[model samples]
Target: MIQLLFILLMIQIAFILILSFANPLRKLVVKGLDLLKQGRGPLVTKTVAATMCVVLSSTVYTITKIQKRSKDAGIVNPTDEVLMARRLLEAAFLGFSLFLGLVIDRQHYYIREINLLRKNMETAKKTKSQRLLKEMSGN
Candidate 1:
């Protein structure tokens, strides 16, 4: 029953996370993973950097937690199990935060790029039409 409760809690947490990050974050994850497989570009590079930072920061935070726990428990040192669980939870949250940030940032970049592309395309079409009109008048 306890295990089931934990699972339900985790599911609820995950749902909230997904809901909170439903916009660009979700899109960023899919795009970043795809970019990773393709193995190129600034998007993938940023994602990889963000991911590494998340992992390292989470490790540091978890170690600090373990240190605090050991001091509180007065056990001189904590067991591997306790420390590992603490670290895992810290890492999970950090990773999620990083992922969410990346997604939002990536989404913004995508929107900007799209806007620029559209503007360029519109300008090109207008110029081409003008050129055609000039040629028609000449004839």
Candidate 2:
């Protein structure tokens, strides 16, 4: 179980590192998560992140207390496995938070791009129509 947790932690770290410098991957991740944001995306993502933060802090505190109690009782390595598991859980949550942030950033980028395009298209069409009307009236 510890080995499995270690492997997962490593994978999460690798993913985060890749996401940091990989623009294409970031776009893909954002597009993939776009469906999730069709409604209340930011709100839901923020809520989840806040909830995870609370859970993570509480879990860490509980784990530390357990470890301390075990140490006082002269237990050896009893908390070692639990600690590894906790670390894995923490890493997973952190990775998720990072992904959510990226998703929000990408969503905003796309929204802005789309709005700019629409504005430009409307301007172009309106100008072309006005020019055509002016030419017809002058003739």
Give each model a TM-score: 0.43, 0.45
> Candidate 1 clashing pairs?
none
The lDDT of each candidate is 0.63, 0.65
How many pairs in model 1 have backbone atoms within 3 A of each other, for residues 3 or more apart or on separate chains, i.e. clashes? 0
Best by TM-score: 2
List runs of model 1 lying over 4 Å from the truth. Answer: 1-61, 64-83
RMSD of each: 11.6, 6.6
Query: Candidate 2, 63: how far from true, in Å?
Result: 14
The per-residue C-alpha lDDT of model 1 at residue 59 equals: 92
Angstrom error of the Cα, residue 86, model 2: value is: 1.2
Tell me the tens digit of each residue's lDDT in model 2 across 72-119: 878657457677566657656655655655655665566558758999
**Each model's backbone clash number:** 0, 0
- Show pairs that collide, candidate 2: none
Candidate 2's displacement at residue 88, Å, is 0.6
